[model samples]
Target: MPSKLSEEISPFYVMEVLERAKEIEASGGSVIHFEVGMPDFSTPAVICEAAVRAIREGDTRYTHSLGILELREAISEDYENTYGVKVSPGNVIVTMGSSPALFLSMLALLDPGDEIIITDPHYACYPQLIKIAGGVPRTVRVYEEEGYQIDAGRLRKAITKRTKAVLINSPGNPTGTLLGPDVIRDVASLGVPVISDEIYHGLVYGGEAKTILEFTENAIAVNGFSKLYSMPGWRLGYLIVPEEFVRPLQKLQQNLFISPNPFVQRAGVAAIKHGKREALGMVGEFDRRRRAMLEGLRELGFVLGTEPLGAFYVFVNASGISPDSHALAFDILENAHVAVTPGIDFGQGGEGYLRFSYAASVSDIEEGMSRLGKYLDERKNKSR
Candidate 1:
């Protein structure tokens, strides 16, 4: 039998929706995909070219376990430029992606039974990551009426003696809500170390997303090239830690991942220094789709308490249609052929909601909304 730890890890439910969508495609049906968080944009050419150049130059050998210095330095410069946070290159550690960066941080920070607090309706994998790191996750429920923003007061109330950290994601997945600097300040005041997931940083559509580092040095900021740079398959991500934690985290990285791909690290340097133009263009297109999605969902009678201002998703309340989001999601897949993530995949707070990703093309978003509207109309007529 697998160890109890392995058994304890829950499956990421959105993958189930995606797999079914794939099966439908394989069976000669078209599916409009909004269930995944990945950007559909092609990687910027300069970043891609950098990797090819590195490969041709024979730069594929194992690199420093902390990643190549150029990439780390580039990341440090980005913090200064993007967030006004002066980070040292020594404090950045690159890994295969933000997932491993967050996981490694948890592994280093968590002792057995230590508690980490996360917002309810969070990314589905957070609790599992906590569990895998030998920690327990304490969930603080943030309501949709509040735009699902984490309440620092409630978060403070949830912290206990065992609480070691508070995990936060801005331009959050499944919601695309941006947490402002005020909220980051409030959370920082709670006296718990913060794990800030800023992977969706550059994808904001409206208000600016703040880094926890802007308020506290006693935090970990996890970011990567996947979302903004459209380099998901490149598998490069990094974390900014307090100066004191650098060596230990470096040792952990050495043992666990050795390093992220050396060639990919070369591409990462190019991505930081030169990929902004392509990334901004993609963000503009995402904003276009986001607006269309919000208008369409509202028109279709899905309740959206507030307009999402970041990332590429709009979390819709689907309780009026069906309380069972999982079943409803699959039903939409089978009948409407439009794939979306069930809110229950997020957490109990998300039970009756569905997260619609606007990462698809604008035309695809329009077609998806039309299909959903037709499906709902037919269902309504049948009920009548």
Candidate 2:
């Protein structure tokens, strides 16, 4: 029999959407992709040049399990400059990606059957990571009407003696909603460790997304270079753990992944020092696409729970069109040739919604929206 662990995990529905979109394109169809969460932009030339230079200079070797000191120090300095928190380099653990940082955090802290709390309609992987770490995921249901913000009172009630951590993602995945300082404090007050995923930090449009370190020293902050630098394929991310977790996480890092790529780490250093300007420019473009997509989606009669203040996604209401977002997603893909993620993939609370990513170019966003609108309009006409 296949391992039970393998059986327990569900597919990342976004990938399925992408694959089906590709199949259509291969069969002589035009597809406008809005399914995946990655930015359509190339990795900044400066960052890529740095990685290439490192490769050409033969800088390929394993870095320290805790990562190169230069990169760690850069991350430490960023916490001070960006979030006003003074983090020591000794506490920073570089991992292959923020996903690993989160997994390591859960593995390092959780005992078998320990529970981690998160908000529903969350990033698809949050609960899976918790379970993979041998912990139970205790989810608090947050609604689209409230911008999918966590209800701290519910979080408080959900906590049992077995709860080990409270995981939060802002400028969040799928929903694109940000949690404010007040909500962070309420979560921290529960006296459980918090894992803050700040991967989409620099992607905010109007307001800012805060690191957990800003509210308390008792949390783990995970941030990375992917979304900011448009460098998802580079696979470089870091974790800022409390002083107490420094060594244990480092040890876990030593075992699971000896170190992330050296060339990538070098590129990461460049991303921090010289790539911010490039990233900011990309963010400007993303903001433009975001606005265009939001306007287009609303015009098509989808209800947005709140304006997305950060990230490049708009999770809109689809219950008016169909209750099964999963089936509806495929129908849109096959008929309209515009791929989008089903809300059911995000969790139960997300079942009646559809998450559209504006990480594509502005033109692509406009075209995808047009196709989707046409498809819906045709469906209405047929029903009438």
Candidate 3:
């Protein structure tokens, strides 16, 4: 039998949808995928060339468990230039990816039975990672009616003596909503530690999302080269933690992962320095696709409560058509050939919605919408 931890964790329905899509493709049918948060773009050549240069220079051996000083320094300068936060290189801890950075930080800060306050319709992995670290997730549901924004008052009410941390994701997964600067500041001022996941930092379309470091030095700024650089396969990320937590997080990382790949870190340095032009370009293209998906879904009768300000997803309310989002997603995949993520995959608050990723090309988005329109029209006609 699997461990209790693994057994209790819920499965990712997105992956299940992907598997079905793959089966359809394998049977010679085409599938336009929107089920997972994956980018369709390849890593820019500039970043790839850096890896080649590193291989030629034989920079393949292990470095400090924290990371190579040069890369950490690059990350430090980046935060200073981008967020106006003068983070010391000593505060940055590089790991295999932001996933481990979050996991290790959870271990560093949370005791067994301790609690973490997470916003609802959150990244599916957040609560599971907290539970795996022996922490209970205290979720505060942010409704679609509120643009999925965090309400300072509700967040304050959720805190307790057991609340060890508040995990905040800006330009968040699923909803693509940004927490207002005031909301972020108010939460930081509550005196609890904050894990600010800025993985989608550079992908904003309609508004700016601030790094928590702008408000307080006590938050952990977790970000990576994945979303912005389109380098998900690189598996490299960094954590900016408070001075006190650095040693403990380093030890946790030392035991789990000695360091991120040497070649990957070498490429990460190039991505930080030279990849911005291309990264910003992707954001514009994503904006175009976002408009296409936004207008198309709304025209098809999927009610989006808010304009997505950042990230690549549209968290749409599908309750007007059906309350069972899980079944609705598969229904569209089987009939329309467009796969979307079921809202329930996010949490209880997501039960009657669907998350559509606009990471595909504009043409693909148009074609998927065309197929979706037909499917929904048929459903409407049959109901009559």
Candidate 4:
């Protein structure tokens, strides 16, 4: 039995860091985690109640391949209400998660050997997903000085005849930098399809994230209930595709997944329609933790690329302490009992950096910072 070439993809390194942290915890040692991107909070009461009601009502059967009509309509209305963008229910494809949404989109749009351009320091899974869909991922390096935004000129330069789409993540993972509308418009002007991952849209701290729909009609908007609604385990997400691509994407979804879980789709409807206030409340909590982590890292002499404006992560330059961020992350886990993600997991431009997620509580972040401070102090003393 042989595995497919795509099955030989590289590991998602953040998971490796998490496994190491778990091992340390199993040995009866405490580890303050800043590595994982998941929220420490539980699902909102409204979402949970909805799920329970659906289960009690015996709504566990399979649904339409695209999703339950109600959930898809709610998702479409969400775009209209929140972003003032008109999306028809017919254009929405409910997915198992944004992961499968990405897979479906790439599969529906790209042919083998087709190329997709993405920023260098991107969410680690983007390239792997492209490979599995039989497409090639072309990365354009983004500099930290520009706050890790993809330069429009560099993106245009990277576009070759085989380029099928440009993938972008706003309130980007690891860096947490949000791209402005100008950049969004520039990329859309290239006439290539754009795939915007807006899973972190509502969780932004400084300002709202821009929807690619605001810039171009030729883009796919992927969003989920996980980050914004604190419902990761629900495994419910949606993608708003261009009208032209909707039916083909639906055909692919029907064969690949049949439909999202029926009860989960009902829960998703409640999440989008009635869970707004509860979801907004979580954003406030994440904002506070974001500030605390930023201040703590600065106090410890780490140079960050920018103050994170949206997502709950702070990407810091770790080259001053060590060039090998992966080794440093492991060292910190062992010595200080704190776990952080190595930037190398993101891409080449992120090699000398480390991503700290603020999804944990303030107290946990404070304790992690204290451990980091003590470790740095001891290192300085030894140097003398």
Candidate 5:
């Protein structure tokens, strides 16, 4: 029999929405996708060229389980440059992506029945990953009015003897709200290990996102090239662990993933060292799309409780129209041909919300919002 863990993992609903969108497109219908967080931009040209050069130079082979020394050094330098933290190259472990970096952190941190505190309406994979690692997830509800930022006090109250760590995402998914520095400082003082997901670090618009390393050494920082460098398909990410955790994480990486692709590691080095100009350009474009999305959603009567100045998403209250976000999301896809993610996919706190990703082109975003306006209007008239 399959283990209960395998049976109990919830479906990632956004992937379902994406699949249905594909079906629609295969049938010759148009789909304006707001369902996935994937960037519409291509990987930076310099990064791509570096990868190609590595491939041609026959650099494709297994690397150090912890990653190539060059990539690790590059990652270490970045922490110093960006966050003013001196991260040693010896503490870095590269992985296939940030997903594996997070999973490995869970495995290394948790014994069976150990607990991790997370925010409600968090990234969809958080609870599932904890469960897979044989840990329990305790959620603290974060409100839309508070910009979906986790309250450190509530998080403190949630901790018990079994509490192993606290997982946080800045410029978070589904909401795109950056946690303030005060919140980060307070959370760091809570006397627990922090698993900080900094995947969207360079994607912030208003103010900078702070790395947990700046406040505490008790952190496993998970980051990758996917969001900022537009290299999702490249499958490259790394973790910054304390010196003590390095060997154990290295062992886990050796047994599980062996090492990330050698050439991809080279590409990651190039991205960190040389691709910032291209990345900044993409961020500028995303900011423009963000403004357009906010205006369009407001015009359509959706309630945005807080400004989403980071990442590429706007999580809005859709309960005034329909309480079931899952059903409503599908209805929009089927009727309006605009694909979006349901809030319930994040957690129960998200049930009556809808997350719109502005990763699509501004033109597509405008058209999708217009289609939604028409769909809602036509539904109201028919009911009358």
Candidate 6:
């Protein structure tokens, strides 16, 4: 057997849901998508123009293993301005989205037997990434009762001497909860290095999202242009590593990725410098959809946590309808023609919930919610 057959990593189940939705659509069924976390908008005109100019001006070649100096500088300056954290351009490593930066962070930080503590109800990819980087993923259960924030005491209990770091995602996927700055500070006081995924930072609906840099210097901040800038296909993101991790991460970048695409990096520069208005506009749209979905789901008797302050998702409790979220999700897809993510995709503690992304247009979200409402109503009648 091939070595690929011997490994047992779990698949990203929400993506499978998306694939099934696509199959249904190809067969002439209308599938309203709330499963995938992609924005339903085009890249900003400024970013597109910059990429075109870069390519025409012969900026297509690989510039540096760490990325073009100008793009890195822009990212550094953006961080400084946004969070009051001064990061040298040398500490920024531009990668092909936050995914590669995550891989590199794990590789640079963890050894084979090391453990990484992450919250339950985390982004689906976190544990898989830890496993691939040769580390054990230790999960601390976070409840919807607490707005899905990790309990500091429980998290501290999960940390062992072998633990290398704590992984946290604010404006987190599936749950859509933003970690409080005080929680971040408490976690950092443990003296463990923290890896904060702040990809959804600029998409908040209420209070501002805190960058880990504002709370701790012993953190790696992972951010990308995809979510906030509506530049998913651009595959451009950067990491802000502590001064000490800079050289090691750069070496990893040199060997693993060489660099993110040069033209895309130029587009990233345009995004940071001139695309704020366009990006913020998308957040406003998502905010409207978020309110719509929350109201609709509540009418369907789906209990929710406190409204999310950031991110474009609503994580709802479906235990009343079905404790098995996977089955409930499929029921919605098959009967309601609306696709959603089962909480199991996130982690163990997520088993009784469902995640609905409001990154689509208002019409699609409203239609999907209507379908869901009808389906759940019929299910209740049937049970009665």
* lDDT for each candidate structure: 0.91, 0.89, 0.90, 0.89, 0.93, 0.88
List model 4 lDDT by residue over 148-260, tens digit each: 77888889999999999999999898789888888888988999999999998987877668899988999999999888888887788889998888889888988888879
Report the backbone clash tally of model 4: 0
The candidate with the higher lDDT, 4 or 5, is: 5
Each prediction's TM-score against the native?
0.98, 0.98, 0.98, 0.98, 0.99, 0.97
* Clashing residue pairs found in predicted model 3: none
Q: After superposition, how far is residue 372 of candidate 6 from its true place, in Å?
A: 0.8
Predicted candidate 2 versus true structure: per-residue lDDT over 1-384, tens digit per residue? 988998979889999999989989998999988888988889988899999999999989998999999999999998789888899999998888888988999998899999998888889988888888899998899887776778888888998999888989989988889887788888878788999999999899988888888888889999888898898888889999988898899889888888889999999989998988989999999889989998898888877769998888889889889999999999999999999999999999899788899988888888888898899989999999
On a 0 to 1 TM-score scale, where does candidate 6 land against the true structure? Answer: 0.97
Per-residue CA lDDT of model 5 for 1-384, tens digit only, reads 998878979999999999999999999999999998888899988999999999999998898899999999999999999989999999989999999999999999999999999899899999999999999999999998887878888998999999999999999998998999999999999999999999999999998899999999999999999999999998999899988889889888899999899999999999999999999999999999999999999999887889997889999999988899999999999999999999999999999999999999999989999999999999889888
The C-alpha stretches of model 2 lying farther than 4 A from their native spots are none
Q: For candidate 2, list the clashing residue pairs, or say none.
A: none
Which scores higher on lDDT, 1 or 5? 5
- lDDT of each residue in 1-384, candidate 3, tens digit only: 888888878898999999999999999999998876967789989999999999999989988999989899999999999888899999999988899888988999899999999999899999999999999999999988888888888989999999999999999998999888988998899999999999999899866889999999888999998898999878989899999998998888778887778989999999999999998899889999999988988788776668889989999888888899999999999999999999999989999899999988888888999999999899999999
- Tens-place lDDT per residue, model 1, 34-88, is 9988999899999999999999999989999999999999999999998888999
Which parts of model 3 have CA positions greater than 4 angstroms off?
none
After superposition, which runs of candidate 1 have C-alpha atoms over 4 Å from their true positions?
none
Off by over 4 Å in 5: none
Comparing candidate 3 with candidate 5, which one achieves the higher TM-score? 5
**Ten-residue region with minimum lDDT total, candidate 3:** 297-306
